[model samples]
Target: MSMMKTILAAVAGAATALALAAAPAQAAPTAPHVRGTSTVPAYSYENAIRESVWVQTTLDGDLDGVPDKVAVDLVRPRETAAAHQRVPVVMEASPYYACCGRGNEGELKEYDANGTIAKEPLFYDNYFVPRGYAFVAVDLPGTNRSTGCEDVGGRNEVLGAKAVVDWLNGRARATYADGSAAVATRWTNGKVGMIGKSWDGSIANGVAATGVEGLETIVPIAGISSWYDYTRFNGVIRSPGYATFLSEYVSSRPEACTANLAELATGSGDDTGDLNAFWAERNYRPKASRVKASVFVVHGVNDTNVTTSQFAHWWSALRTPKKIWLAQQGHVDPFDFRRAAWVETLHRWFDFYLQGLRNGIDRAPQASVETAPGTWVDQRTWPAAGTRPVRVGLGNGDGVTGTLGGSSGNAKRTWTDNPDLFEAEATATPNTPVPGRVAFLSAPLRRDLRLSGIPTATLKVKVDRPTTELTARLVDYGTAARVNYQGPEEGITTLGTESCWGSSTAADDACYLDTAEDVVTDDHAVLTRGWQDAAHHVSLRFRTPLTPGRWYTIDVPLQATDQIVRTGHVLGLILQQSDNEYSTPSTMGATLSLDLAGSSLTLPVASGSLPPAGATAPQVKTAPAPATSSLRRPDLRQLP
Candidate 1:
């Protein structure tokens, strides 16, 4: 690849260059409060200009022996570029530059007749640009105006986006289309913060993992930290062709990226669904440990798309300063659910971290979690720091009733892996069992209990076949009003009129169509779900085939959650062989024998006074799988 070994002289802005030449090296300026508060009244939105810059990357993404280009669309207060005052930056790098769009209404970046982008989706640019912050929207490599191939979340994705932070901090270069050097981003301060949802948010996580200088913080909402986890669950293919499918959706000219797309397909390990070096290179957890930036994670607990564990695992690995927002919605944005509160919290977050202002953000609550419909609480830490994991064993009962005990004698129950069984059907009847599935219930709790961490199902079972997959769900069985945050959009309807977070502009208006209220209804809600391939019990990278009659004990981690089961509501641990919501059914159809003595669901239940000595957790009869509760959830993978 051709390297533009230019002197750093040009990379530094005229203002910074002149200062360096005129004076000896001095200490950098102290962190200052650029804006008084995060309130909208602190600044105006109309004086910002929408612009674009093409940054150069070190990776030859197109394999053309030339570094690729990253298109950076920026919106900043006009005076900032004029050298009136310095402002920190906020960026969102995305693969969905034009295809399918972003957010619920699917808004794409609109361009004027002259080729300059006119409007951007969501309100980041519209609202934050005027609030003493520069909002940058970047088109990831191989997409939109960027030149090269899409590597999904591989090294290319990390380096290409990392180059932007380097450029802002005067460590990288950029050029215009005609090969002329572009203007250095010298007007504003070099601090940069990244944020986005889904793929866009994943970019933030990837870049932050690089520990790149100038990347001060990241706000990854419903983002993926491990590409392998995104498509596979413990060695079983949760969704085949996910990389290829997403590649097709984000890019229009597939022919140009054919080689890159081919690599993704080949490296996915569709045949065995095993993790290899390819996936190891894409995992951000290891990289995140070295991060120099702070983190602000927002995710939906019921999100099956990226899943809740994606956020929890990543959050747990991060040693940097961090914050979290655990919503009750599935693959949904908090903007639609919390609105004004989200903006205020995010504004304060940016002000404190990026602008280096003491806005009480760090001193404020570390988590704002939604427990149920319209119910939320703040805490000092996610999962409240001292959560105790309790193992409630499978107890005595008719195969259909849930009898959870501390140590029930060994009992056997059998069910074949039924992939077609609907989640609604599994929790529908209170005393019946659905075909191909078995339900274990718990007696109504005398006192309310809360779950605040990952729930693991330890199952001792014998498989009749070489390999099989099991799906475990920690569900609430009582009829209570809960948020219908099952699928995309989180049951919020799009409205007619536009609501402006700030004053509007004719071309780039600060207003967007408001969202309707959440659909809160009285029904059974699936708190969280987890899946595991029986063959991958020992390791996700290797398969250990099950011996016909030999029993194996496996721990399958269920999706993490932060909700409380109200008093009188029974908790159900439903076990199934297949889940149509994420993957296809396997035909081996081996029966699984559950040895209750060794099987128990380990849950991070809230601490409270025990019921009493000798009081077993109790048992309850279960409803048959809802023959058609599919209506309750929208299509999986449907973007919000």
Candidate 2:
């Protein structure tokens, strides 16, 4: 039997003796204990009572000399306070307590009249709290109950969270609003696991990167590790209003972080999209080598808000123990797709790592990859260990037929790079006669082709201007119906009815309104997209402007993904200048002169076989690709 089974079997007898945290007064069982340490019962759930307090951090974000206090709401097994049992902690430090909300319900933290948090968002407390873990919902400094200025992922933001882990380990101080000592985390064993989604999850990454003691593990779902990559891609401004808007959104008042906001504006380098000390300070990926805790990462393959590369590059750099889940949804919570299974796996993970239960989670597969909306398979390693790079050439006079080993000498096509055109508009059809786009399609596939890992396009090209914004999209084009993984909506449908998880109380509930899965008829799906600044082709930090009419060979790495193109499907590569959703449109246009002799797209193929010599491949049905219908620009591009 595995170590997990051995440990679980060894403690099976005591599991029945453990009492439920939320049980009525008539309950007679005691809390579960193992090896002199507290452990959650495998059969029963919810042995904890809800509580609240304010914790002081070392950083005075507002420069007020007195450090700011973050609100911490707790729920843990009540029996721990009765005896020597001390439980582990699961923390989610968030800046979205007042705005945006958490999970599918958009549930905000509700506050009592006295300013203490009356209820927290999500089912973390409802589920895990009952499972012998203390759940801490912290309001980040400068947001909600926490006092200070919002730093927007600056030094203050990272330091503020680190202070919490210090306090939990008995290295820092915490007090109440009345200047009295707050209740200690006396019930905890000082081992903590942090988890959250998006910005909340980013904090978890930042704190874990500090190598802070007591942070045993972290689960960062759809989180950003490098803020620069969040707003800029390869020195091109991918999105605007990231710094100023996010800081303002979390602050209760505009003036609360006015100076801080100004500092973000000047330092973000939005105008130039260059790397500086400002972006370096906000970078969590660079500190990944310093991370000490085990990490469990979850991200959607089709996520556009934070993007997939953010997770891909970070996962590649992590040296410590790690696991990943790549889902098929777009910017969504994993629970919405696979709630029960996710909860069960998470339970086993925390139980093993933090509680030292030895559930054999470490022996489980390191990665889970989605093959479809409702289908997934375990992988021995993320990005699937090894794959050969196959070079597919852009051939045919018009370069519309995507083929491999067919070198068309000096086959050049020119398109005026129109800044106003959207990517969806550029990739409207396989033979789209767009004025501002050039597209290439491979011959109808002879057999099923599985593409995994990052795709790169090495182009021998020249431009009429000194600099230009470039975009490459590896698209799947065919008549076969598939998941609508195109931007900007990513094919999600909101629903009317709501679903609830765990148990509900008068103050806090896990119930949330539901959103129906988005399953749309799709002719072609944008598989992976990449952006670049022509000037930054040589180096991201240094700009090397191209001479007009100069041939410059540049390799653009497309977004990383795992997708299967069924037999009879054709692969397409679309070259365009701008995407309104991904970045601000350039004011000027440029002419791209392509030289196909030395230019080809390199793809990492995980599986598929080449056709026999002279064998006629089957014809693939073609449909007019959806431009306005599917790949329309999103409202998020137009930041308010």
TM-scores across all candidates?
Answer: 0.90, 0.88
lDDT of 2 by residue, 1-640 (tens): 6999989976874665554534566844454544233344432223356556667777777766787777777777676667756788899998887877887667888866775555778888776765677788887888877788767677777777787788788877777657677545676788999999888788888998899999999999988888777777777876576788778877875666677788888988776667788988888888999899999999888777788887888888899889999887777777776677787888788888887877688989999988766679998987776767887776643354334335566678777877657755666655646677777766667888877788998888899988787789987777554555553445455567777666556778767666545666667778888888888899877678889999998888877888877787777788887666677643348888878777888988888843421111223344644555465555553211
Candidate 1's clash total is: 13
Stretches > 4 Å off in candidate 2: 1-49, 183-185, 397-405, 485-500, 513-516, 585-587, 609-633, 636-640
- Residue range with the least summed lDDT across 10 consecutive positions in model 1: 608-617
**lDDT of candidate 1 over 1-640, digit per residue (tens):** 1334344545556669788799977876532224354434344556566666789888886688888888887777776566567778888888886886787677788776766667777888777776677777888888888888777788877788898888878888877556677654565688999999998888899998888888899999999999888878777676667778877777655777888888888988787878898899889998877788999999988777888888989999999999999887777777877888998888888888887778788988888888777678899998866789987777746545546654356568887766566777766664565776666667766777878989999998898988888888887767777777753456566788777776566676667678764665554678888889888898898888889889999988998899888777777787877677666434346788888888888889765422321234344434444446344433444331
Residue pairs in candidate 2 whose N, alpha carbon or C atoms collide under 3 angstroms: 20-47, 21-46, 21-47, 21-48, 46-130, 48-76, 400-441, 401-441, 402-441, 402-442
Which one wins on TM-score?
1
In lDDT terms, which candidate is top? 1
What is the RMSD, in Å, between candidate 2 and the native fold over all Cα? 8.7
